[model samples]
Target chain A: MSHSFRVEATADRLPEANAGLDAWWSGAGLPDEARFAFELVLEEIFMNVVMHGSPPEGAPCMVDVILDRQGDGVVMEIADDGLPFDPLAMESPDTAAPMEDRRVGGLGVYLVREMMDTVHYRHSEGRNRLSVFKSIGST
Target chain B: MNVNIESTEGGVSVARAHGRLDFGASAEFQKALEGAVGAKPKALVIECSELEYVSSAGLRAFLVAARAAKAGGVGFAACALQPAVKEVFEVSGFSKIIDVQADLATALAALA
Candidate 1:
């Protein structure tokens, strides 16, 4: 089964996007860990599109999200009509740095990678597409 | 997210965070923590028993608060993290940088 929804590329719309996923997951009957991974990865990638991939020309950007059940796991596909950017290509932050030397940002993409089993990014037809999948039983 | 900050008689400020701590709530949560730190308490302990979720943005808020507490010479700790939030903390290496305890009593005792 698959569920689809769209949201404007803005920080304010993040809660709506999250709500859509929450509503879908309510009936999906996935384990608690898998649900947490899905929610975290969705927030990370969705915010990336809103914060970094928005167009510079002030055009309205839109993000389309699809949650699909594959086998015993789930796959999420997020496509945004914004600037071309690959979150996977971004450098991972130094998670080992001391608090005083640590930077505040840059952990979002890193967390997404750590939580999801597979992540793929592609830019085609003027859209940036990101797909993330995680097995329900793997935690 | 709802954050309630109160100071104990021992000069420890306990900030209870309830609900999801995501990007939408990060700025507000950061401000609240910074405010608690600004009061110059001997220590600050975040009670997270009711905090259902935390995203990277929420982690950023914790980072900022920890930095502020350090700069201000206030001790800091977080306790009773939900399982999922704890996983994110460990994955981000926040468990190494910040003091984490099993419960509110332990967090307060550690700061003492």
Candidate 2:
């Protein structure tokens, strides 16, 4: 089964994205862990775009999210029509740094890469699309 | 997410976060943490006993708050996280920078 949804590219609209995912996941009947993983990944990517995507001034931006069930797991694709930024190519934050020395900027993208089983990114048609896969029913 | 800031006997600000802390709640979560840090208490404790989940945005809030606390010469710690939430902190290496304790009592003790 596959489901797709869209949200405005604004940080305030994040709840709507989460609501859409919850409505779909609840009926899809996936395990709690799988659902949690998707939720975390979705928030990270969506928030990054909303916060830093730098859409055209005064223009509206939208983020598209698609979920497909793949065997015992699920594949998620998040695409945004905003400034092109490949989160995959970003540097990983020094997680071992001291609290005073640590910076929070790149941690979200790093978390997305670590949590998802597989992740890929591409820029096409002026949209930044990120693909992530995670297995359910098994850690 | 809901955050309730409490004052411990040791003059620590314990911010108890309930429900899920994600992008949807990041703004409020960050605000609450900022409030706790602004008070300039001797220490700030994030009580996550009831928090079921946290996202990268949420983690960022904690990091920012911890930084603020350090700047103000206030201690910072988080405790009683659910297993899944703990995994998020561990994987993100937040546990390495901040004090992640086993329970609220321990967190308060550390702050004291």
Best by lDDT: 1
lDDT (10s digit) by residue, model 2, range A1-139:
7899999988788889988888888878777666877888898899888876865577657899998888678899999988888888778999888877888778888888888899999999889999999878543
| Candidate 2: residue pairs that collide | none
Model 2 regions more than 4 Å off: A52-54
DockQ of every predicted complex: 0.88, 0.78
State the iRMSD of every prediction, in order shown.
0.9, 1.3
For model 1, residues B23-79, the per-residue Cα lDDT tens digits are 999999999999999999999999999999999999999999999999999999999
Q: Which 10 consecutive residues of model 2 chain B have the lowest summed lDDT?
A: B20-29
User: Which CAPRI tier for candidate 1?
Assistant: high
Off by over 4 Å in 1: none
Model 1: colliding residue pairs? none
Stretch of 10 with least lDDT, candidate 2 chain A: A51-60
lDDT tens readout by residue for model 2, B5-71: 9897778888989998877788899998988899988899999999988988788898888888888
Assess the local accuracy of residue A107 in candidate 2 as a C-alpha lDDT between 0 and 100: 86
